[model samples]
Target: MTMTDSAPVAVTEAAAGPEPAGAARWVTTNDCRIVGRAFMAVSLVLGVGAAAVGVLTRVERLDPSAPDQILGGLNSWFQMWTLYRAAFVLLVVLPLFLGLAMAVVPGKLGADNLAFPRAAQASFWAWLIGSLIVVVSVFAGGGWGAMDGVTAAERDAMTLTLLGAGLVIVALLSGAVNLATTVISLRPAGMSLLQVPLFAWSMLVSAVVWLFTLPVAAANIVVVYADLRGRDPVAFGLPESPGIWGQLDWLVEQPAVYALAVPVLGIAGEIVPDRLGIRLDRRGAAASIIGLFGLLAVGGWSQDYFTAPADHRDELLYVGVGVAAVVVVLAFCGALADAARRGSVRLQEMPSSALAGSALAVVLLAGATFFGALRVIKPFELLERSTTTGVFNAVVAAALIGTAAGVWHWWPEILSRPPSESRGRLAVLLLLAGGVLLAASDVIAGFLGAGDRPFVGDYDSGAVGGLNAVAVAGSVLLVLGLIAAAAAVFETMRPDRPDGPGAGDAAAAGLLRGAGS
Candidate 1:
């Protein structure tokens, strides 16, 4: 029999029945589920590792002399943040989402396997290794790419960043092609274009989006490498030039908070209907999200980058991207509301539902803050844009939690068995609380005349010091949330993990009862 009609059965076959003949010896295996889970595990670790660094940076701010003692002075602090950004932007989120694509899309599409399995494997390895190199290269480059007086090691750092990024692009391109092909060609007998899950559709669209955005980033990386090596300074432009803005505008995906927002919103679409026992009133929701993201990628009308405060406060004026992002979501919520009105809907802090809500809140708050900026503060009167550090922190934290949520949502299918419950609900709660506190404090401090990178300053006997203290508390909570998340993920990957379906059928059955209700 053809594979398309049997794709769903194929997924459970590895565990639900006796293995295929010589299944262990099958060398050309193109298992989408395994690759996806592998990608998810690796990306989650990278995310937690970066967050741990962020906690260190925040802790350093609590004590005035800590940077010098703990982080090796200001130059290294610069490198630390740079590495964190590189890891956060280039290393974790996209791959984590794509990993979900790898695992979930085929099953959703009723495909036997990805269209190009070898290529998908290549894509994963390239991204995994390249991201590792890209992050390490930030340290190797010694903060000199954006600084002066480059040394031999620093030059190597620049070269590695370019090489690693190039490889990542290669991986992305391969996966994009493979995924698009799977969705188009591999549907079961009766499935059509619109029948695919919104989650899978979003990933397919994001793959095409990658085709547009990442190559430009790769070119920028090459230009940067050439400049660091003294190849053509005038050709590449220097650190403080407008060209750097373009480079950052690309890397600024987190601070901008829209590119990955599409798939995440789609994730919410998938979760809500299942958990709430309602059919999604999904009219125009998927298409609108895709269109909004495209506009967002173009910097959203008059906006330059949404994530950073210091980068372009001088020239950026429009709230086009923010408004569109917000509207698409509000439209989505409106649809969800309609569904709830007609069908059963309940308030849920289930891991998936909570993640979707928290992520949407983070992005909405950011868009609102910028919209509020236009009304409250003039551009010239603005404090250092770096004071907007909280926006970046909250967005990163939310996205990380969303990635964790995807893992939880798909864990059963990806592993071909039932899953164990860990502290997922707690993890989601801690992250949401942390994000709100972080954003409020950072934005308030920025408005109150705090400069970027000011780890210590007096309160002037007012709320500034209090807000700073509150931000520190938020950072601590963020650390706790991440630790909780890491524990949940690691519990799944343990070779001796006790989460086997045989042991957990009762729990799984209970979960089914809950979702069905």
Candidate 2:
């Protein structure tokens, strides 16, 4: 547990020069900015694909009577359905934030680069390769849940998918560790943890949460993979059941689902005050709320699949955690509001998309927590219903909004250019509309008795079908928003731009100068 020094670092501002060009530059560069951009670029592209998959999955549910008509088979539909959920969180939202942290956290802390630069690079490549494996294997008859059954080749593909998942988790964990170490061991002189930028502080907390929780998920995959390969099939290895998805579904559920969104608080904290040209009020309390949020989001203990059908959501501790999250979010929002109130501002100035997006992210999160509280209420009986999907839609949409906000707020440090406010606004509005439509429809559908698992022949109501259509529309809007955001990011890297490939170094150098000032 010692920090070993390895690889070259641009420790001085003078080192902010142009980097190598072409394939070798991206493939072999040790710069944290380039490494981070690679992660963001790949993740955003995959996010669009994942969101598209989600749209298709929802469309499949439009006619639940036929179930497999759109996808051709129960197993195929199951693969796409589970793939949409898994990829959206794992391959898209989490990695997008990790990339942003990698690019921005070091500069915020006055550090020259990530504590372990080569490891960051390795983590990016490993994650990318593993993501490809997961996507390919799923299409090749391997996915988290098998609805009907599987052939021998498909079984082998399932093992590959598991391996890819484990690799992806480990890669994300490695990146998180790098960020945590950079924050802890590389702070500038006279700066305490309390004085660190809110976003950096949030990343530290998120890193700890990821370390505590993600390994358990990795362990889940390991056990399931072992059972699948064993001579005798037990509970997890049965190829005909959806047990594997059940065991892993907790990651996308309540307390665990919130883990991927911890950075949303950080992004909001950093952006709101910065936009208002004022320091945050109750900074310490703000940090504490963030920490508490992250703490509640550590859901390694919330898995209930191994036990006999006893739902963990019914537990008092789980219900309390879900309900308390709303208060934490409200407290942070109040702090931001106080800061904004103390600022000398004009209404004509209006809010920037970054500011609006940050605020919207918090709102979406609060709405999600409200739904979570309702779902845990025994009388509501919303457990294992589409309410779970509502929570996920809201949470992931919040994360995406936060991602756009961060990019707009820190375009200089991340994208090496000024962000286009109009494009940013368009993206945020689309995401907001999409999030509301998707989440609200799902919640309403759940209240109408829509089962969590689709295509089991229970959903024949016209109201549910209309809600499903709305969700699909929301998914379409989400995809468009993501595309717009991605385009805005890539525009900064135009071939004619001076800061295209090696621009991140210069950006980092500028951030260091600003921090020193």
Off by over 4 Å in 1: 1-29, 63-67, 141-150, 188-195, 230-246, 253-256, 300-318, 346-384, 416-422, 452-465, 494-517
Best by TM-score: 2
Worst 10 residues of 2 by lDDT: 493-502
lDDT of 1 by residue, 69-188 (tens): 667665556566566666666667777777778887887777768988888877887888887777777666543244324455565666676677778767877777888888878877
lDDT per residue as tens, model 2, 35-75: 88899999999999998988888888888877677778889
The lDDT of each candidate is 0.60, 0.87
Model 1 residue 439 CA deviation in Å: 2.2
Model 1 earns a TM-score of 0.79
The predictions' CA RMSDs to the true structure, in order, are 5.7, 4.9
